[model samples]
Target: MGKSTLFNRLVGKRLALVDDQPGVTRDLREGAARLVDLRFTVIDTAGLEEATDESLQGRMRALTERAVDMADICLFLVDARAGVLPADQVFADILRRRARHVIVGANKVEGAAAEAGVLDAYGLGLGEPLRISAEHGEGMTDLYTALLPIIETLTPVDDEPETDVDAEEDPQGPMKPLQIAVVGRPNAGKSTLINKILGEDRLLTGPEAGITRDAISVTAEWGGREMRIFDTAGMRKKARVQEKLEKLSVSDGLRAVKFAEVVVVLLDAAIPFEQQDLRIADLAEREGRAVVVAVNKWDAEDNKQAKLNELREAFERLLPQLRGAPLVTVSALTGRGLDRLQAAVLKAHEVWNRRVATARLNQWLTGMLEAHPPPAPGGRRIKMRYMTQAKTRPPGFVVMCSHPDKVPESYSRYLVNGLREDFDMPGTPIRLTVRGQGDKNPYKNRKKSTPSRLRKHLGKGRADE
Candidate 1:
């Protein structure tokens, strides 16, 4: 229907993937789009197709329907070249019943041949159809005209005087929402957990593995803070990911992890701490994102105490880089232990953003050096002068030393661990760099010259002279 093309044009970016194949877009992607002077959130949905309730296509259709219900106005597009088929009429009927406002668009009308199809759209009983060429950038003025009346009715007018200026301001104004990505291996119950958090079955979930093929984001509020949660597709080992679509899905999930401030690595309690799970956790840590390990399917586990002990031991042994990170147990099926998960997420985010003052950091460094001094390589004691925090968002530090290259990895690890313990900054990635005092000697290399004639004459005559 060229809906994605129009979506790209309005957003001024190719956010939604387009292809000659139908149903290329299987997810509802939302973007802030501008058309002339009107600005609104536009959702590009999957092409309407007929399928059963259990098939993959059926789930895609279900997601599209949910998008329609959430939208204020629906853009019902039809291919002017292909004309209105039975499927178009069926979808039009559904939209007429579901959407509050409908704007019928006959797309691909770049030539006179599409006139007959443009007329055919009127028979769907959606009022007059607006002929458009989304590819050629034509008929946008008409679209703006059609949307202006709706926008005016929807935007509220303020008549009362503002008494409390601060109260009138946006509550969540100063801070950006926390971006969280929920990632895990296949059948790890990632979607179910997110749906529970949202208090709606916004994401499709089932017993089947690899059902999700896109990284979907939904805005939510948890503990009086705004959050944008991403529900990513389940990842499998690279060797097992044979299909092209699955590869794309995994790539998308990895991209989400990179963009996120915090990542929740969901694990199946029945088979917790698998090799793939460790890989995912390590990836999040390496990417410098705060990580929280969530062991799901707790309701099914009979030996809770032993299982928890096993989980803790495995977490320590397998991924020591993320030591002391929050390990939460949850049951996405029954919404058990969700509060703890939320608390852990918030706490990890706080720790990730922690900044240590220079005074406190230098004091801590002094104590660390006094407790166990740096090693003397080749009988030369490496003098440790001072230390200061370079930046936050993982807490990076720079230390002035006699020789930066001589600082052993073991000593660096010790300092990092001490900093983590002293500052109460556990689980967050820490970076430590060593720098040497560069070239303090003024006359490093002076050219040798013969003595001056006056000095030679003043010197007493010798046999060699």
Candidate 2:
């Protein structure tokens, strides 16, 4: 009924300890909590305590302080039945002094026990308190309204908002073509793979490698899905690359990685998953592009099984960032495995470009919250309110919570991993952002009136004058 139960409700799990026992939670247990159209970092904290800088309790105090420091806002939960206690007053002071913002929640608010507490909670000085029954999900509408501001405030300034709004509004039948970039080290057969897929020497090819000098873009249709394919020059290690043309090609390839929805890393099957191959894969991952690995020239390999096993092991060791990535062996020379490779590429691209409707995301979020509620650390429950997809083309999402900054990296990974699994988005990079509710809207009013019409009217008036 209090922060404890609310934390449990948000995490969708029983991980956050909730019993009649107070102060059972000690350390911070972080998890993803979904609220309406947003996802947030839900931190389970041990209750706030007074401790010196050097004691064990002090360290715990410091940890809680850190969590508060990271949070965009604090969900200051109070037991409505008990009314506002001296402890809540002290913690509210601490939150006001240090936290960027604070939201007061009066938990266990089903009956008369909540009325006095809810009234007294206003004395915490965090503003009006929200009455809620975390156990029964009562007063959620008020909670949502109170949290809207915090969510809007935490959105990254550099993030591109309204990215697909226009497209969503369009009456057009489908979305635009996906942009995919094919990249690899020289002699990795990048050009060969692209040319073969297109059924023509759209890109110049030769027995000699590194023939492609520039990043060439070609539009192609596969499986009824339109795609813009970028065929890039072979990348050589920086020190070994002395030619100006090679340097330009490598730079171009790197740029393509940034813009690509999916990056196909082709490797020579005879020496797959080498250092360079790993480097290319890592680059794609860091750039947040969906990745697909193609082992080219597989038909030429004599010890196929051993080589395949070796490649798999190398992938595990060198490119764990691309876990569950689709790995296909193809002989660009023979067109073997070509269909599988194409299918994998398309699938990966689709995952990268995926967008979940807000309603569905909220439903999934509730399930998550019920499964793994946020823990209590420093005697306070971290509240996660909602989650939503903010962008695609690598499928990024934002979770609105009471404290966005307080979300731990491990918990972020947990959310990202969950998203990949639940959405069948393997091989794609997923980004999870925690935003405190009610972030400010940056939209400003522009002076309006059709400039041409206004000018004409003004001219007519002036002529009459």
Candidate RMSDs in order: 4.0, 29.5
lDDT score for candidate 2 against the true structure:
0.78
How many clashes in each candidate? Answer: 0, 51
Question: What does candidate 1's lDDT look like per residue over 1-465, in tens digits?
Answer: 888889989999766655666766666778889987788999988866788487878887888888988988898999988899999999998998999999999999988889889999999999899989998988898899888999889887689855776655867545788999999999999999999999988787888897777787889897788999998889899999996767778888999999999999999998988889989999999998999999999999999999899889988999999999999999999999999999999999999989888888888888888999999999989988888888877778999989889999999999999988989988999989999978787767878666799567667566357
Q: Choose the strongest candidate by TM-score.
A: 1
**CA lDDT of each prediction against the hidden true structure:** 0.88, 0.78
Winning model by lDDT? 1
Report residue 325 deviation for candidate 2 (angstroms). Answer: 2.1
Q: Model 2 segments beyond 4 Å from truth?
A: 1-177, 223-226, 375-380, 438-465
Q: What is the lDDT of residue 290 in candidate 2?
A: 87
Name the lDDT value of residue 143 in candidate 2: 78
Worst 10 residues of 2 by lDDT: 17-26
**Residue lDDT tens for model 2, 1-465:** 356578777777654545565554444556678777768878777667777565545655766787798888788888899887776788888898999888888888887766888899888778888888899988878877887777888775665556677767887857678888988888788777777878865554656666665566677786677888888778877788996556656787788888888898998876777777788888999899889998889989889899888888888678767888988999887788988987998788777779989888888878877887666556566688888999997788999987666677877777777777787878788888888886565544655657898899999999999
Question: Model 1, 463: alpha-carbon shift in Å?
Answer: 27
